[model samples]
Target: MAGQRGTRVAGADLVDLLTRAQRALVRDLGTVLEEEGCTVDQWRVLRALAAEERSMGELAAALEIPHPTLTRVVDALVDSALLYRTQSEEDRRRVSVHVSPLGRTKLNRLESLAAAHERALATRIGPETVTRLTDLLRDLP
Candidate 1:
């Protein structure tokens, strides 16, 4: 029983550490996203849409954003002409999002910025360490 309790406490500590690390990373990336005229959440949506047209539900799941929040984000992006909404030809109830030419231009710029940010992170951590961390993160539960 005592061992189980200790394990639980350690698990909680791990969770707290992960949370802090995630927040700090997001805060750092948020600055670069902001300079590109977007919030991190918005960038996630744009990044997902950059590849191909996706339904609203697809975007929501791909980005792990709640449906309501995604709706607002999609609306704003549409308003800004960064994305276009088209009703699915097979289903009138479904709407798909596609990045416009302007959105593509913006996405290309943001991709460069993100690459530089990633390079800076690798430089700080050492390339081998960054690769190991990336693998570990991919395997995280």
Candidate 2:
């Protein structure tokens, strides 16, 4: 079934439906995250910083993100003290970011919220279908 622009209108595949849903989902989640005093970009930055210290370039690469935009997200997190960027002593030109205690706390809170949200969704959609959806999404190239 072709949609208005001749794109497939099928909803059986999760990706197409999910991609279309993201605009609204992002707005709703953005509102929720904002109410928690964070932005979507800030949340992503914090997640990236949580694993290990990374330079701006390294973080951008790990995120598959462009530099300048990611820099703005990093700047917000840095200024909030949720992340700290320190210059490498041996290489003054390079800087690395680490998550702070505050950042970890917030990230944990967000994780809990996400888990609860997932449970609720599973209840509505059936756990088996939800699990399949998650698996397919995880396997997507």
Candidate 3:
């Protein structure tokens, strides 16, 4: 059956719904990230670097971002002084990236914002449902 007066379709696939939900969620919760002057991809890099320094390849793999795309994001962050790159002492050809103090500060802010966003979502969807949804997402192929 369709929604309301049967004006909406009922056979939408999971992938379609998931993608639309993701876009909407991102749009809804992206305020903090924007205020920090960082894109979601850049925020991911910052979060990763907050843990420890990493090589470009390692970062790309960890974030599941394409190498070329990661390179552009890293370049922008580096230019913004949020991240810096250094050559490996043992392997001059290899370069590693680390988050600067500014990056860490921004990351902390973004983390707080993310927590609030999650809380608001939990309130909207119910905490138990959020947990179950998270578990389901994690288990997806």
- The lDDT per prediction is 0.87, 0.80, 0.88
Q: After superposing candidate 3, which stretches have Cα over 4 Å from the reference?
A: 1-12
lDDT of 1 at 126: 94
Ranking by TM-score: 1, 3, 2
Q: What would you estimate as the lDDT of candidate 3? A: 0.88
Candidate 2 — which residues are off by over 4 angstroms?
1-18
CA error at residue 44 for candidate 3, angstroms? 1.1
| Tens digit per residue, CA lDDT, model 3, 77-113 | 9999999999999999889999999888878998888
- Candidate 1 displacement at residue 47 in angstroms: 1.2
Model 2, 6-84: lDDT tens per residue?
Answer: 6644555666678776676566567667767887778777888888999999989887879999988888887888898
- Model 3 pairs whose backbones collide: none
**Where's the lowest-lDDT run of ten residues in candidate 1?**
2-11
Which segments of model 1 are wrong by more than 4 Å? 1-8
RMSD of each: 3.0, 3.4, 3.7
The positional error of residue 66 in candidate 1, measured at the CA in angstroms, is 0.6
Output the number of the lDDT-best candidate.
Answer: 3
